[model samples]
Target: MIAAKFQTFLILLTVLAGTALVARRFNIAPAILLMLSGVGLAFVPGMPPVELPPELVLLMVLPPLIYSASVAMSWREFRNNLRPIVLLAVGAVIFTAAMVAAATHYLIGLPLTVGFLLGAIVAPPDVVAPLAIARRLNLPRRLVVILEGEGLANDATALILYRFALAAIMVGHFSLPLAAGEFALIVAGEIAFGIGVGWLSLRFRKWSRDPQVELTLSLITPYVSYWLPEHVGGSGVIATVACGLYVSWNGPLLISSATRLQGIFFWDLIIYLIEGLLFLLTGFQMRALYEKSKTFPLDDILFATAVVLTIIVIARFAWLYPATYLPRILSKSLRERDPSPPWQWPFVLAFTGVRGAVSLAAALALPFTLPGGEAFPYRDLILFVAFGVIFVTLIGVGLTLPPVVRWLGVAEAGRTEHVAEHEAEIAARRQALDAALKSLDALTAEKEISDEVMRLLRARHEIRVNQLPDSLDPAHHDVSAAGTALTRSLIDAERKFIHDLLRDGQITDETRRRIERDLDLEEASLANREYREGPL
Candidate 1:
C-alpha cells in the first residue's frame, strides 16, 4: 500500500510537469491542459484512483493560494476598485446562488434547499485559471484588479452560503434574519482576526532576524490565520485575504532584504507546484465519477448538468450589466468619484466565469449520511454537475478568452496603457536614485566615510541612472533591447569561462559557486528589467 501511494504521487508529479511544459510551449492554458492530461491518465490500465479529500483543499491548500495572491495584489488598486469587486464578490455570488436555487427548484424539481446547495457550490468563479489567461493577454488593469479582488473574497460568500444551505437541509429550518446577522458577524470577525495575525506574524519575523526562520514563519502564517476563523464557523477566506493585504502593504519596511529575496523564490516554486498538482488531481476524479455514473440515470444527470451550466453562464451576464452601471445612475457622488466602464469590460468579465477545484471540493465534502442516517439529498447528482460545470467552463471559456479579447479590442488599450506605465516606472527609478544619492551625501557629511567609498557609491548610482531610456520611442526601445541582448551574451561568455576554470582545477567548488551566484543575480535583474520595459 505504501509503495502504491508513493508511485501514484510520482505519477502525478511527472504528468503535472510534462503538461505544464507542453502548455507553455504551445501557448495553451496550463490549467486546461493539466486537467485534460489527468483525465487521460486516470483510465490507464493498472492506474490507481486518487480521491481528493475535501479537507485537503479547504484546510491545507486554500490558505496559501489566497495569501500569495493577496500579497501580490496592490492594496491601493484593490481599494480603488472596491465597489465593482464587492458587486461581483458579494452581490453577484448571492444573486447567482439565488438564481440557481430558483431554477433548479422549479425547473428540475429538486428541493429548494438542495438546489441552493448546488448554487452555493458553483457560484464563485475560480481565480487561478481566468487570472492567468487575463494577465497573459494584458487585459485592462482595472478588469484584472476587479477579477482578482472578487476571486479573493467570493469564496467566503459562497462557502458561507453553502453552510446555510447545508444547515437548512439538515435541520429542516432556517431564518433569513438570523442568518443575515450571523453572516455579517462572520465577515467582520474574520477580517479582524486576519489582520491581527498579520500584525503578530510580522513582529515575530522581525524579532527572529534569521532568514530561514523568517521564511518558515511566512510559510505558516497563512495556515494559522485560516484555521482559527474556520474552526469557529467563520469563512477563513476573508481572514486570509485580510492578512495577506496587511502583509503586502507593510512587509517592505519590516521584512529584511535577505528574507524577501529568499521568500520570493520559495513562494514562487511552492505556488507553481500546488496549482499544477491541484488541477491535475481535480481531473483525476473523472474516472471515479464515471464509474459512479453507472448507478444513476444517464439522461437525468446529463440534462441536469446542461441546465445548471446554462444557468451559471447566463446568471453572470444578467447580474454584471446592472451591477456595473446601476449605482452610477443613482448616486451623483459615486458617478463623480468613479465613472462607469465600457460595456465591453463587463462583457469580458461575464465571459470569464470558469469554475475550478474549489467547487468540486465543496460538493465532495457533502455529508455521506445526514443526522438521521439517511443519505444526503442529490449528493451524487450535485457532484456530477459540479464536475461538469468545472469541465465546461475551464475548457470552453479558457480556450476562447484570448481571441474574445482580441475581437473586442480591449487589450489594445491595455497595451498602450502598459507602455505609458513603463515610462512612468523609468522616471520614478531616476527620481528615487537621485534621492538615494542625496541621502548618501548627508550620511558622508555626518558620519565617518572615506572618499574612495563615496566615489564607488556615487558611480554605482550613476551607472543605474544611465541604464534608463531617455524616452520610450521606437528607436530608443530598439537600442535598449539590443544593449540588453548584448549584455546577456557577455554574461553567458563569462559563465562559460568560470565553468572552464572549475573544470581545469583553477578554482574550488566553493569559489565557483560564489561567482556563479553573483552571475545568476545579475542575469535575474536583467530579466526583471526587460519585463518592466514591457513584453517583447
Candidate 2:
C-alpha cells in the first residue's frame, strides 16, 4: 500500500508539474487544470484513493498558505475595508450556516444535527483558490479584499459551529447555552493565540534582521499559530487566519522592504504548492470517504452533497442580499465616509466561496467511528459532497465571473492610485528629457561634439519627449521626485520579470547571471534612496 501510494503520489506530482509548465504557456489557472487532472485521475485504473491523515493535512498545508496570504495583504487595505469584511466574514457566515442548516434538514430529510454539520462544514469558502483566480483575472482590489476578508473570517466561525455539532454527536448532548459559551471561548482563544504568536513573530523578526533568517522565521510562524490553538481545543483555522492578518497588518512597521518583497514571493510560491497539493489530495481523501460506506447508503452522500451545495449557494445570496447593501445605506444615512462600497461585487465574492481541501480535511478529520463504534455516520457522503461543492464553485464561478462583471455594466476600472502616479511620472520624464536637451544645446553651441551627432541626439530626444502631455513645459523643468520614483517602479517591474525568467530556465544560464546582478543593483539603489529619506 505504501509503495503504491508513493508511486501514485509521484505520478500526480509529475503530471501536475508538466501541466503547470503548459498552463503557464497558455495562461491557464493551474488550480483549474489540477481539478481537471484530478477528474482524469479518477478514471484511470489502479489509482489509489487519497488518504491524508487529518492532523497532517491541517498542519502541513493550512498554516503556510494562510500565513503567506495574510503576510501579503496590506493592513491599511484590510482596515479600510473592515466594515464590509465583518459583514461578509462574520455576519454572512452565521446567517448562511443557519439558513443552510434549516434548508438541508427540511428539504433533504436529514436530521437537524447532520444538516447543521453539513452547513458548518461547507460554510467557509476556500480562500486559496478563489483569491488565486481573482488575482489571475486582475479583478478589482476592492473585490479581492472583500473575498479575502470573507474567506478568512468565515472559516473560523464555521469551525466553531462544527466543533459544537461534533461535540453534541460524541457526548450525546446538545445545548444552545453551552454552544454559545463555547463559541465565545473559541473566538477569544483564537484572537489571543493570534496576538501572542504575532507578537512573537514581530520581535523575532526584529532581532533577526537578516533577510534570510527572518524569512526562515516567517516560514515557521504559521505552523505555530495553526497548531498551538488547535492543540488547545481552539479554532486552528481561525487562529491561522487571525495571526496572518495580524502579521500582515503589523509586520511592515517592523521589517525591511527587501524582507517584505522576498516574503511576498516566498509565500506566493508556498501558497501555490500547498493549494495545488491540497486540492489534488482532496481527491485522495475520497478513498477514506469510501471506506465509511459499509453502512450508510451511497444515496445519502449524493443527496447530502446536492442538498448542501444548493443551500451553500442559496445561503450566500440570501445573506449577501442584505449584508452587502445595508452597510452602504447606513454609511450614507449617517454621512459616513466612503459611502460607495462595491455592492455589486458581493455576488461574485459569494459564489467564489468554493469548498476545497480544508473542507475535505475537516470532514476526514471526524473520528472514523462514532462513540458507539458504528462507524462515522454519513462520512463518505460528507466527503463526496464537499468535493462536489468545491468543483461547482471553482469552475462555475471561475468561467462566469469575467463575463458577468462585464455584462452587469459594472466592470471594475483598473484605476488605482499607482496608475495615477504613473501618469504623473510620465509628465516628469518629459520635463527631464527637455532639460537634458537644453544642456545638450549649450554643449553643442560650445562645439563640444560634431553637428551631425548633436542633431541626431536632438532628433531622438524630440521624438520621445513629444509624446508627453501638452500641459508640462519641457523647456523650463526637470522631472519631479515623484515622477522619478514612478519611473523607477516601472523599471523594477521589468527587472522582476527578467529575474523570474532567468531563475525559471526560460532564459539561458549566463557565466555571471546578468539579469540577477542587474536586479540586485537596481534593488540596492532603491534601498539606498530609502535610507537617505525615511521609508514612504
Candidate number with greatest TM-score: 1
- Give per-model CA RMSD: 1.2, 9.3
> In order, what lDDT does every prediction score?
0.93, 0.72
For each candidate, what TM-score against the reference? 0.98, 0.76
Candidate 2 has an lDDT of 0.72
Error of 2 at 255 (Å): 2.9
**For every model in order, what is the number of clashing pairs?**
0, 1
lDDT of 2 by residue, 1-536 (tens): 78887898788878778878987898666777787777667656777565667776667877786777676677688888887788877777777778777987787766678767877887888787677777655567788887887777777777778888888777778999877887788888887888789889989999888889998988888888888787877778777777888877777689887788687668767766667776666655545545566667777767776777777788788787677666667676634656554556666666676776767677767887887878776566666777777777777776676677666544345334334544577777877897998898788777769778878987888866753544333331234335547757887788777768877878877823776666666666555543323211
lDDT of 1 by residue, 89-123 (tens): 99999999998999998889999999999999999
Off by over 4 Å in 2: 1-9, 256-262, 286-300, 328-335, 340-343, 415-418, 421-536
**Model 1 residue 508 lDDT?**
96
Candidate 2 clash pair list:
50-284
